[model samples]
Target: MEFNILNQSPVLNGHSVEQSLGHTTELAKLADRLGYKRYFVSEHHNMENVIGTSPEVLVTHLLNQTKNINVGAGGVMLSHHNPFHVAEQFQLISHLAPGRVNLGVGKAPGGTPLATAALQHELRSDIDSFNDRFLSLKSFVDGTHDNHKVLKISVDTESSKPDLFLLGGSLSSAKFAADNEVNYIFAHFIKNDENLLKEVASAYKELYPGGKFIAALSVLLTETEKEKKAAKEENSVYSLKFKDGRTLRVTTEKQVNDYIKNTDEKIEVEKSQLDMILGTKDEILSKLNELSNSCPIDEFMFHLPTADAALRNLTIETLAPIHTIHKEKAGIL
Candidate 1:
């Protein structure tokens, strides 16, 4: 089974931003030494706890800091930026890393409404929707913008194009990826809809033969039974804290405005679900095998939810030697 680390540059125990970023850099190096396949960080904005606001910038940082290890974005929220621009950014990243950069695009707004508004100025009603924008992004990256050939976008690199992965929680997105001949990641951690995951995996197989289907889940590798229980307890929050730094899933207008008005406002969101692989070595491996049998996914990406620095390092150290996906990937998850 292929294992990858999904990071969000989390700020543990309210550490300074510099420390959090430095810690993330160290983790990237650790992943490189561990033999994990990829180290992909998600893009988030206006969150005190998570410092990763830009994936392209972070990808560049990871590439510079690590010698080997695929470095890429778990996803770039494509809706916020221009498609050509996104393609161009990855173009540089792909050439810099050469066969290690990935451009995973997702439809969901990666931030609150306020943040999205900041990103998306001059909205166009007649412009592109998520599907349209994604198609354009694909075209730009592939250098196949369907217009005058004189105006086609090119990567200006001899290396291969960044492997494009569509991140989603629905079957429609799976079909979109398959139809477009791109990679697909079923983000079960976002929403643990088992039925949807099965359907998407099945649809991907039927839609595109030999396509890559990834199962990305939240995971926490604990050292002891006591640690496992504590990890679960720490993550088992009953309410959402998006308005504050406790969470980052706030998307509604009211919530975003409230957050903007008072960054410390304690707003609550309904139904905060937690789906993770939190257990010992044998248990994690066994659960991974079970998930493999349960779905037709081709790869597995593990997203860590903890901000505890020691625990995080322990998880990586514990899993690195035994659960390394490749002899060397040094790049991304």
Candidate 2:
């Protein structure tokens, strides 16, 4: 029942890069102070709305700002990078932060098709091949080079590799993560399917031999009515982007219906319902309790709303109690 923070450092509206970084760092610092378990940032490319393109750089900056909180990429887009290079870069970061790093990786290309192509360049491959490369990268991390011809990762520095978490919004990722024996983090917000989340987690657990699987949920919590409306508007549109690249905003029930009328894709109401963990503290906590009771989620990564430093700080303050409840339930303290 442990809960941590996962952020995309969203550049909402037309926020500058500096503003996004400042806001993210402030949130990380707040998370560290609030006794939240860890704070992870995501990776995206050419998404003007998101500033989390370089998780490597983000992790480095976050580590500098926070003392106790574990910071790493909620994932590096593994479908893009050379496995060997990714392994080395992560190993280096692990050395810098030691035990305070979590190396989460994802198979998603992460962004529009053009952006994906640019980021992946010639490294793109089918899901199977991409997963095979992930396995190769993991082997390198474990210091097992028993069968290698030329290319390999060996860090001269006196530091261990960070703990690995496989991130996904799909069942394929769950199966791959389980087979590879790494922890899994389901991107529930993007996937918008609670049943699928459970199914994936169940599959991972059934395949894994007593391993960890985390069901990371993205949430937007607020106190006041105005704040709540703003959050809903933000989340509704953000959720719509996953469908295709629709620009229409959807907040109210009517707006959601209207958006549906404009698009060919049927609106995933059940999945969208899963994203509305937005409300007062008690209301959101109750929802989380229900989620934990149904899903075998070990950790919950709360992706707080980030407009700027003030809003981000307000979110952490308001959401701190929920995180505490999760920690207490897990006996973390």
Best-performing candidate as measured by TM-score: 1
Q: Note the residue pairs that clash in candidate 2.
A: none
Candidate 2 regions with alpha-carbon error over 4 angstroms = 12-15, 122-128, 145-152, 156-159, 224-226, 238-274, 305-309, 321-323, 326-333
Q: Which tens-of-lDDT digit does each residue in 128-198 have in candidate 1? A: 77888898888888877766266544526345678888988777789988999988988888766677877
Candidate 2's TM-score reads 0.81
Per-residue lDDT of candidate 2, residues 277-321 (tens digit): 777767777888898888677778887654545666665776784
With candidate 1 superimposed using the best TM-score fit, by how many Å does residue 82's alpha carbon deviate from the native?
Answer: 0.1
- Full-model lDDT, candidate 1: 0.77
Q: Distance (Å) between predicted and true CA of 150, model 1?
A: 2.0
The worst-scoring run of ten residues by lDDT in candidate 1 lies at: 243-252
